[model samples]
Target: MSRTDFATIDWRGRPVRIECQWIDPERGAGTPLIVFLHEGLGSVAMWKDFPARVCEAAGARGLVFSRPAYGRSTPRAEDEIWDVDFMHRQAHEVLPALFTALKLGDEKPWLFGHSDGGSISLLYAARFPDKVEGLVVLAPHIFVEDKTVANIEIARTAYRTTDLPQKLGRYHDSADSAFWGWNRIWLHPPFRDWNIEAELGTIRCPVLAVQGIDDEYGTLAQIRDIAPRVAGICELLEIPECGHSPHRDQPDRVIVATASFITNNRRQTP
Candidate 1:
C-alpha cells in the first residue's frame, strides 16, 4: 500500500497544504523517481491506481500529489482569483516549496503530467533545466486554440446543467474551488492569448509528449508544435481512439510507453 502525507507550507504568504502519496514505497532510493502531476480538475484521488501501476511497471519510485486547491489539500480562498500565470506560479513557486518541504532535494525526478499539469511541468523543466531527468506530458497545451476555448465553454455548461460538479466533488475537498478556479481562468478572455511555445526552447531534458487522437480539449498541434522548438528532446505519442486523458483511456499503452521511455532514457543518462 502507498503512504499518504501532507506538507503544510506558506505559499503566496499564506498557509497551504499539499496532499501527497508515495507509490511502491518498497522501492529503493537508487531507483529513479517519477512524479505525477494531475490535470486542471484532477486531484490525488483522481489518479486512482495509475501511478502505482506505472511505478510497478517502470521499477521506479512514484510521487503523486494534489496541488493546494485540489483533493484533500487546501481550499481556494473566497476572494482568490487565478490569473493567466497560475500555471507558471505553480511551476516556479508552489512545486519547489513542496519539494523542499518533502525533502526531495536529493534527486531530479521524471515528471509525468497531464493537460495543465503538463504545461506546468514544461514550464518547470524550462525554468530549471537540469532539475528534471525527463518528462512525459499528455494533452499539454502550448498555445490556446479556438477548439480549446469552444470545448471549455461546453464544459462550463456541463458543470451548470449536469452532474459534473457532483462527480468532481468525490475527488475534491471543495469541488467548487477546484472547478471554478480552473474553469474561470481558462475561459477568461485574456487566456486565449496564453502561450508557452517560446519557453520550450530552454528544456534540456528528454520529453515524451502524448495526446489522444480525439482529445476534446486540444489538438495534435499541442504536442506536434513541441518538436520544432525542443528539437532532439521531444518525442510524440498519438494514441488511436483515445481522448483527453490517455492514462485513463489507454492505461496499458501509456504504462508500457512511459516505462519504456524512462528505461531507455535512464540507461543513457550516464
Candidate 2:
C-alpha cells in the first residue's frame, strides 16, 4: 500500500482534511488519472490494494481518498446530521475543493466509484459535463429501492449486534462517525425519494456500470436503468456469484473489465 497523505480543503466554512493516496504515480503525467471513490461506509484503508491493482492493469495513475467522516480524515461533528442533498454537496463542493487543493486544475479524470461513490461520480459528471473523461461505477444506486432500504436496515442491526463496528474501526478513525453519518442519511425517510435518473442525461462521457448478479444491497435494475438515460456510451456488466463489493468478491473480473473499458474509451489527445 502507498503511504497515505492529507489534503486540507475548505468545506462548509471549515477546514476539512481529506485522506488520500496515489497509485502508480511513476506512470507519469501523460497517463490517464483514475480517481477511486469509496462506498458510503468506506475509507482509504478499506479499499485495500484494489486501486493499485486496477491502476497497474490500466496503465493509469490512481487517486484513492477517504471523504470527510471516513478513515483518518476529519470526522463529522457529533451534532451534525447530513441533509438529503449530501451526495450533491460532495459532488459539487467537496470534490472540486479537493481537486483544487491537489493542484489538479483542468485535468479531467476518469472516475471509478462504488456504491454511493458511484452515484456521486454520476452526479459530478452530469453537473460538470466537460470535467470528466469516463466513468466505471459498481453497484451504484440511481434511485432508492425497497431492497436497498431492507439491506440498510440489516446493516444497521449488524452494526449494533455484530462486530461490524470493530471491523470498521480498522479503517476509520471514528467508526461511529463514519457509520452513523452514512447510515442515518441513507435510512432517513425523506431519502427514499432520492433519485438521480433525471440528472444522468447530462453526462457526456462513456460510462461502464457494473453490478453483481447476487448483490444483496441492490438489484440489476440499478445498472440497467443507466443505459438508456446517459447521453454518452454506457455499458453494463453483471458478475455471477458476486455481491455488492465486486472489487473484493470478484476482483479479477472487475479489474479486467474496468481496464478494458478505460482503454477503449480513453479520450484521444491531439
Ten residues in sequence with the least summed lDDT for candidate 2? 1-10
Give me candidate 1's TM-score against the actual structure: 0.97
RMSD list, candidates in order: 1.3, 1.0
Output the number of the lDDT-best candidate. Answer: 2
lDDT (tens digit, per residue) of candidate 1 on 55-137 = 99999999999998899999999999999999999999988889899988757999999999999999999998888899999
Which ranges of candidate 1 are over 4 A from the true structure? 267-270
lDDT of 2 by residue, 148-261 (tens): 999899999999999999999999999999999999999999999999999999999999999999999899999999999999999999999999999999999999999999
Off by over 4 Å in 2: none
Alpha-carbon shift of residue 119 in model 1 (angstroms): 0.4
Write out the backbone clash pairs for model 2.
Answer: none
